[model samples]
Target chain A: MSDFIEKFSSISLNDIKNVPESDFPELTAEEKALASQAVTYSNRIEDADSISNLNDSLRNKTFIVGNKPSKADLLVFEKVFKVASKWSSVEDVSKHRHIIRWVDLIQNTLVNVPESEKLKVSLDIEVPREIKE
Target chain B: MVVTLTVAAKAPLVPYGSLIATEFVNRSNGDGKIDLQVVDQKSVDSADANSASKLTTSDGKEIKGEADVLKELGKLFPDVLQEVSKSQDLIDTAQNNLSIKNFKELATHLEKLDAHLNFRSFMLFHKCTVADIAVWGVLRANALMGSIIKNEVYVNVSRWYNFLAADERFDAAIQNFTKSLAELKKSEKLSKGKKESHKA
Candidate 1:
């Protein structure tokens, strides 16, 4: 099982879609690697420890990879966005505030899609975890 | 003319959106001429406009996609299609709301549709065009639409929906779909639909 999991993870990393030049002109290597990483997020998001790593990675960042939206953002968006609406409550959502933020941003900024197509995250209800004195 | 629409040979035939567009055209027209053939889903997608166009008057005019099938059905009834096509956005909006599982958002969307129906008897035109058939058909298919309209939240949408449902053909279309659908074990037909009784 361990061997299978290891091999599976590596295989998923190579599942990244090449962002067409028309979508976002020549992506630097950093963006390309980030896009590849998006493919393995399904695993990362499930592991409690790895999920925190994702949350921390997204703290100050907007997109998952490069500052400009690219295939990486969309790949992660594909994994996370679908389940975001069913997070149960604000507690589950507020725990991943940064992830939620990135998901919402990708939906709106990544593509000039229609309003109905966009996934909405009501950030207002997610109150501060603790008001720092 | 024997109108035939092709969809993939998938199970638990969820008839909404473009998937059921041909059925909508066939049943609403009461012509019973349309034949929904189950072929390889790949062949339907590979059928380009070049080939599909040439198939205009025959036993096998390949429909590129369900939406293309919709446009073909539209061509058969120009005036009805024109009006109903305008209100297709309502179908899309309601579908989105349902997807997110946001009842609040759905009510707001329904309010807008309700407002539209407030002034006019139908969606875009004076008569029940494909617009009424399409919108009403989808909402009836949804499980939650029952309670949402139970108290009649949006009187206009409820009124319009029931008004359209009163047509026996609309009811029959649903009955036919449900009876056929019952044969297949429910796959991930509609995640939203899974929680409720699949009877609808």
Candidate 2:
């Protein structure tokens, strides 16, 4: 099954509809629209302003929803990471400090050595260039 | 004055209606002058109907559409009347500017809203006004703009959107919408099943 369907299979429809917590409210209608927009927008074109705006908004934030990395934060992190990676001329992520901090915290601190090490093999990812140097 | 608003749960304008009702209730704060009743049309209609979106006054005058209902509320209350009009204008501009075909126009409108929201927490000076309600409602209702807010595409606008969204009143309103929509969908599925059985 699709990633979406697999996720859906685990949750009840009632669970799907309700924004059950103080954490991330179930994706509101607007969030759904934004998701569609984000997917479509990314498929067709890249918007640098979107990346910059996300980075600007995250200036003081530790995570997207809370201090810890939630699924919402990870989803946003992945999307913004895609945009940040596309900035051709920037030698490193110095300009996008918030994003780098978030990604590092998730990969190095949140995920344990084995998991991150496995991710490294699959993703072939290095510490963000700034952190590496 | 008791004002009951009947709103279609699936309508794109539903969020605005909910926000208006929530804001009105908050502003009233059990003063007993303004008793706001919000009715979901999903229970009454087999299918969602925009015409069911109306506001009935205590005197029994039915007002229709987001603009009309908001306008009447402004007339009756007169407290946030100017703010209501300003909010509607901002909503109109934001709604009009959302276009997949025209990225430049969308960016321009986004920047304009971002700048407008830069220093202001609410659309108005300090308090959350109808302008914030209408714009946030409309933006949230729009799928693309909703994503923009969800993703925090514009820093100031995202900050402001998150603030209003965090309001318990807003959360309650959204919960009601979610329940009503789910119920409507369930009913729709059952009805479809009945039809299929009859055909079989």
Candidate 3:
């Protein structure tokens, strides 16, 4: 139980935001415009399709860029769960086969962050301690 | 599909969402189009100020900055300012308001936002979609903001941001925004340096 709690506790959302911006340099105006369009289209599609399935699928799947799960997976997974818990519509969609498979995969594969390593990362000060408690 | 686009600006700061929305509309080739509606609040305010100095209100009251404008513009034009204010509110409430100390934490927040946006469903539905474009745009903007700010405490946000930044689709956009931001920062520094040198 402590291990599970620690693993969950160790996962911080802020880590997800910083990694990429640091790696990529600046973009051109045209590129920025295109990227913005791409993201907008992506959201529209999600809204049009099975929002529930999308949310559930996201929760279940590990965001493994290559073979192994990266911090990306953790970043996405946490939000998916948060939203799922928040919205009833999304929770209902979690019943889908693909959604279930994806969530299970994340929980089974990526839930293990060693206790010692977990201690090293700082908890977000803004996050209510009572939530973890 | 017929797409309508609008570009609205209030003042010094362009609402990040509006900026991203405009960028998205511009990027969408023929699939959908945007009609930009630029509401210059600064100009409107200035006009109001000028009018206030000229005459008293019909209600026997002195005009003021926002009040004069509201009185003269009626309900329609004032709505634009209301929208802008709402956007500003979102910015104020943005979760990543804190200056992050660790890169990992930033990455986490970015990823969480990304997931909340739900890009995969967009990909699943339409080959080229607005959601994809919007998410990518916001993510790129966030990346640039994070870089400029230099507080990488949000590991998840940073990691997710990096993932998109490295992707081929976003590579160009990320680079472009970053370059512009970097150039702006450089010019700012150069000007500051020149000012110091002048003082010396």
Q: What's the number of clashes in each of the models?
A: 0, 4, 107
Candidate 3 B-chain TM-score: 0.32
Tell me the tens digit of each residue's lDDT in model 1 across B1-200: 66665544331222344433444456544543566544422234443421111113365554553334455666665542445456556544544443333577666666666545433334653344555655664576466688766666665566556655644455655565555445333443554475575656
lDDT of 1 at B153: 65
TM-score of 3: 0.28
Listed in order, each prediction's TM-score against the native is 0.42, 0.50, 0.28
What digit string (tens of lDDT, one per residue) describes model 3 on residues B12-81? 3222333333343345343433333344343323544222111123344433322222222222222211
The sequence of per-residue lDDT tens digits that candidate 2 reaches over residues B117-180 is 4323346543555666667666666666766666666765776677666665566667766776
Q: True interface contacts reproduced by each model, as a fraction? A: 0.00, 0.00, 0.00
> List-wise, what DockQ does each model earn?
0.01, 0.02, 0.04
lDDT of 2 by residue, A1-133 (tens): 0012112212221232342323333565555554444444334325566655555545434445422223444345444544554433333444555554444444443222233332211121222221111
- Model 3 agreement with the true structure over A1-133: per-residue lDDT tens digits: 1012113323334454455532323445554443344334334433535444353333322232321234444554554433333323433442332333333345434444343422121111222111101
RMSD of 2: 16.0
